[model samples]
Target: MNGIPNELTIERRMAVPRDAVWRAWTEHATEWFCPLPWKAPEVEMDLRPGGISRVRMVGPEGEEMNLTGVILEVVPGERVVSTDAIAPGWVPQTAFMISVTEFIADGDGTLYRASARHWTDEARQQHEAMGFHEGWGKVAEQLEAVARRIA
Candidate 1:
């Protein structure tokens, strides 16, 4: 994990069914999944290996971040792996910052984990210092809330 700088790891357990959690993560156009503060009005997802998932999250000051990443693997109601970056496609916008998110089932719920890989230690430390924990933690909370409601 040392070599992978700018890397961020988050693990959370939510009380929801695996399938429901998967839907929250995979289903496009589910605004509930995006949650409050960051409004994701639309999302396009293929949910298959090699397929691309496009997501747009609208924020304050009319700010919008368009995220597009390819699905590396998907095991139905179990696991999903995808790499995220600022680039328009699967390409990395910055070599120092990239992310891989993994969803795993833990007992009656699902355990969500995301790892951010950076090109250098400096970048990693910078990101950590920038409050990644709270940022990702909020999204995780949103995911759990939506999943529980739909389940």
Candidate 2:
């Protein structure tokens, strides 16, 4: 969980300001979190350390995936790290991947970095096989569009 040995990342250069991207990430996630034909209809982001970071995705056939996690760290307009290992008030839960997202200022836009660190190598491999690059790339594109609209 400490190295790139078990991780998947999606980095993009968005043609928008860092704050705009941050807002798209935190405020308008439901509008862009999931790939099309699937939807994140319910999303909640309490972006402080120990706050709840949650999302519920519904597929075209009514399948559902709910991720309710705790925010482990946050730097306003810069970064956030969250994991599903613990619930609120330090309660324990099954651990999966820990996600770290950052926004850095570029010349005229923001550099967005989103990485998922898994507890096991198998998990990383599974994620890759599940099309992490294509899925996350599409989501990032959606996020950029949302940011542009609200900027």
Candidate 3:
């Protein structure tokens, strides 16, 4: 849970300001959180420590994946860390992974890094096999487009 062995990370150099990127993530999450053909119809983020971060993604054929987690950290326009290991009020839940997203200033744009920290090697492997890179990469692209549009 603390090292790279059980984690998967992806990064993208966005063509938008860091604040815009952060807004795309925090305010327009549902618009770009999922890969194309899959939409996030519902997303609720409190954007503070111990707050709720929930998203429900719906696929083209109506497939759904709901993720409800607790925000562990939040540095406005900089970083956010959330985990399914716990819910609001510090309630424990069956954890899948801890998600860390960073928005770093890069010249006039932003550098986005998103990491998924699994609880075990098996979980990490499962996520990778499930197209973590492709999925996350697509989402990043979508996020950049949204940020650029709203910038």
Best by lDDT: 3
TM-score of each: 0.77, 0.95, 0.96
Report the poorest 10 consecutive residues by lDDT, candidate 3.
1-10
Residue 48 deviation, candidate 2, in Å? 0.8
Evaluate model 3: give its TM-score.
0.96
Query: Which candidate number maximizes TM-score?
Result: 3
lDDT, candidate 1, residue 45? 67
lDDT of 1 by residue, 1-151 (tens): 4455356787888878777877787762445534467788777767677677677888766788777766667777666665554333456644445566666778888888767776677877887887777777777887777788778
Stretches of candidate 2 above 4 Å error?
1-3
Task: Please report the TM-score between candidate 2 and the true structure.
Answer: 0.95
| Residues 1-151, model 2: lDDT tens digits | 2457798998999999999999988888889998887899999888789999889999999999999989999999999999999887888999889999889999889999999998898988898998888999999999999999999
What ordering of candidates by TM-score runs from best to worst?
3, 2, 1
Over 4 Å off, model 1? 1-6, 28-35, 84-93, 96-98
Taking every candidate in turn, the Cα RMSD to the unseen true structure, in Å, is 3.1, 1.6, 1.6
**Candidate 2: lDDT of 119?**
89
